[model samples]
Target chain A: MIEWLAARAGWPARWLLALLALIMLAGVVILAASIGEMPIPLSVTLASITNGLGITDLPLDRIQQGIVWQYRMSRALMAASCGAGLALCGTILQALLRNALAEPYVLGISAGASTGAVTVLLLGLGGGLIGMPMGAFLGALAAFALVILLAAGARSSTTRVILAGVAAAQLFNALTAWVVSTSANAEQSRSIMFWLLGSLGGVRWPDVGLAASIVILGGLICLCFARTLDAFAFGEDAAAALGVAVAPVRLILLTVTALITATMVSIVGAVGFVGLVIPHAARFLIGPGHLRLLPASVLIGANFMVLADILSRIIVPQQVLPIGVVTALFGAPAFALILYRARPST
Target chain B: MSLEGHELRWMKHQTPIVDDVTLTVQPHETLGLLGPNGSGKSSLLQLLASLRTPDTGRVRLGDMPLRHQSRRRIARRLALVEQHATTEADLCVEEVVQLGRTPHRGPLRPWQPEDERIIRQVLERVGLAGMRRRRWHTLSGGERQRVQLARAMAQQPEVLLLDEPTNHLDIQHQLDLLALIRRLALTSVIALHDLNLAAMFCDRLIVMHRGQLVAEGTPATVLTPALIHEVYGVTAVVERSPHHGRLQVHYLPDLPPA
Candidate 1:
């Protein structure tokens, strides 16, 4: 079915799929906004969002409007942005690194963020809420730089890059563990652990604005390199021969991936597996052209994350699970399935 | 455009792989690069293609130094078909061919009808029109090489650099592909192990031995038995073919000291 549409419609089929994905994304985001402890209706949720946008401005109940707009809408939007950004990062990394296993988490960007956030939280490295993200960003950059340094030595193959990432991830994770053990009291430890597992409970409007803008801007920038990424299919030398400045393109894309991953990691507290799995899912659905793959991964990832957020809220009786745990529960099995399916057929 | 290399030298681990090689190919001339294994034929092609910058020299395309030109601009004029260019991406033959259009199109520019026409023409030319949708992994090694050639042809380059492009092709495909490349009449540098094919197709031949250009001449002049013995460690009788009037290399089995 996918091949037929792609063949028949040529380039337009991707846009058509994008439109379908957009509608699906909207539906899920609305559904996410509707479900919660307060239980607002779908119509009210839609109205509240439009009212918040100052589009329709329909008269609604004060408390209901505030809850829907202020809490649920922000959370859901943040989730979508996080998902979209992480998926974009994954797609770019996989293409540039030429590895199916390449992702922000695998590259240790998320682990670096976790270590940085833990440092700020427990070691009092930074002052407040703003400090945490900045520290995480710096840490993420540090880890990425270290990986690049290690990988850029003699015979800088893709496998070497992945190995460097593993080393960085392990080092930062150990740092996080050390900080938590040395400084955190029991109460602080519990909250820190929850945050590390990933929580949307504390997100608000500013975070929504920040995440959405960053993701959209990042996605647009990446979209512009879609052809360049396609040039990399046969590897770096082929891309260079195809007129792509391989070094500059790889640097720009990897930096963009790092920034997006770090920003989302700071905002949502290290949500795992979405970046690692969503691009593969998107590739499986659509073909491997980055033009379609980028947007498809973004839309599917957005929808997946919003639904996961909904599940996280309602999975237990009167208790919200960490969003990361919910994603890993589904992501791990899907990851395994992808590995099995992608295994070499003799 | 004419392609020239001026004292091109590339070193790996302090040892020169392409040792101060210099040559030039006029526009539309097919130059053959010949060498035994590890003799730097592929390295010379890579340097000429600007995929690797020479350690101590420069390559030029027409009037401009290659390094002075942007990669995209170079790609617009020169296309390379590397030996073992494979991908893990699940792409079809058509999709792989379409990537050849990367240097021609920009991100925001819509795919032109001209681009599609070119791609279709190249695929048909490579005799893979029926297999446009065939997955890349399913194709045999020869088929992959043909697909890669089709891709390079789609670039519509003025200069083509191929590194052992006929490696896995059958005899028929080898002949046909060489004929097609010769017919294209682009300034081309093809690294080849098959001495007869190089003699049949290339306008000029340059033989490399131990990272040095040992001989550069017409195939009749260069494919001498002594040269073949010194470079390839084989005793080969080089003769003009009665059928096509090109040089043919016939190797004799090594016998114990007689």
Candidate 2:
């Protein structure tokens, strides 16, 4: 039925469909914020946001202000930014690897980030706010560099690239596990476990801003190379024949995606599924043109994350599930459906 | 507009694929390369297309060394159509053709009217105008080859390199595609397995045996019965086609033994 509608609507109508999805995403965010503890009204939440932005004179109580501004707003922003970043990374990775199964985690970016965060937490690198995230960023960069080295050495075939990613991911996972096992403190182990599963529970305004900047910058960079990404979808040799400087472009894209994935991992822990699910969802809406697919993936990813975060909050009474669990729960079934539907035709 | 390779030697895993071969294609000329399977026709074409770097030789486009130019710069002047169209993702016919404009387009500018016009003209030239929105996978083998041709044409290149373009095409479509290539005034280097089609379409023929160029000239000069027997180990009779005034080959099948 959707295919029938899509066929008649043309390309312009697809854009309209994407816009409608975006509106629905915004509605989900607002609804999510209103459903939490203390039951803040929609008008009160809107007024608080407006007041925070210095747009109106609608005054709110301090606790109400804290609820809207300090807690829910940052949480929502984190959800959206992480979602968008993961999805964008997934879209780029899929093109780069030329495999639909390629995602940020599959390439060891998440494992690398988690290892970094775990190292900092176990070793007690810094007694301040900046220690864990910085460690994760460096770790992510290291993993990215190692994967590039392996893939480049093997001449960058799709099979070799995936193998390199899998090898690096396993190495990092083993190292992270060792670190957690040897650590004497139970608190450190618990924290590491929480991070590996992912959460947006403790997001502050600064973390929100940082995540947003990384996502925005990374997203813009990816979009700027959308044509190159399109070239990659045809495989490396075809892209090279089309004049893409394959190795250098792949390196730069991998680095940029690594940076964005690290920033997200630092802020919200290692959220899965958003990177894997959102691109497929976007492809379902728009065709495989990277020009449309990248931006649409970002929007849909953000919406998916926000929706997942809302589900995490509402699934239990006064107890929020880790965001990663919710994403896995929703994403796995959807992924299965896509595979099942795609299998017959393929 | 001219392509020249000097003492070209290429190796794959230390096994020579193009051994000390020298060749040239003049502007507005079609040069057909013919060889038995594994005789390195495609490898030589890859060298000319700059898809592979020769181990110890130089390739020149006009007077400029091919290695010195950026890929985009070279792509603007020369385009290559590989044997198979194997993309991981599906694209419509028009979208695939539009990829030809990659070299001509600036990074910041969106698709302009001229790009669209050229793409449309090329698609029409290839007789694929009606399949503009059809997914590439939905197209038949012949249609896919035409779409690939349209993509190469959209490049508006001075030189075109085709590797076994008629591999999966029907005989009629193969003839039609070769005819289209002949009509285009661009310098073209085509690797073909069909000697008859190559003889009819190409202005010059280069024959390779065991990764070495054994003969080079007009088809009538190079495609002797002796050369065919020596290179392809097939006994064949070369005769004139009454319908087209072209040379045609009829191979003698081996007889069954008691």
- Which number leads on lDDT? 1
Tell me, by DockQ, which candidate is best: 1
**How well does model 2 score by local distance difference test?**
0.84
The DockQ score of candidate 1 comes to 0.61
TM-score of each: 0.94, 0.91
Residue B233's lDDT in candidate 1: 89
Candidate 2: C-alpha RMSD after superposition: 3.0
Q: How many angstroms is residue A68 displaced in model 1 relative to the true structure, after the best TM-score fit?
A: 2.0
**Candidate 2, A77-158: lDDT as tens digits:** 7898899899999999888877665677877878898888888877676665658778888889888878778887424566
Worst 10 residues of 2 chain B by lDDT: B82-91
Off by over 4 Å in 1: A1-16, A55-62, A124-130, A152-158, A343-346, B255-258
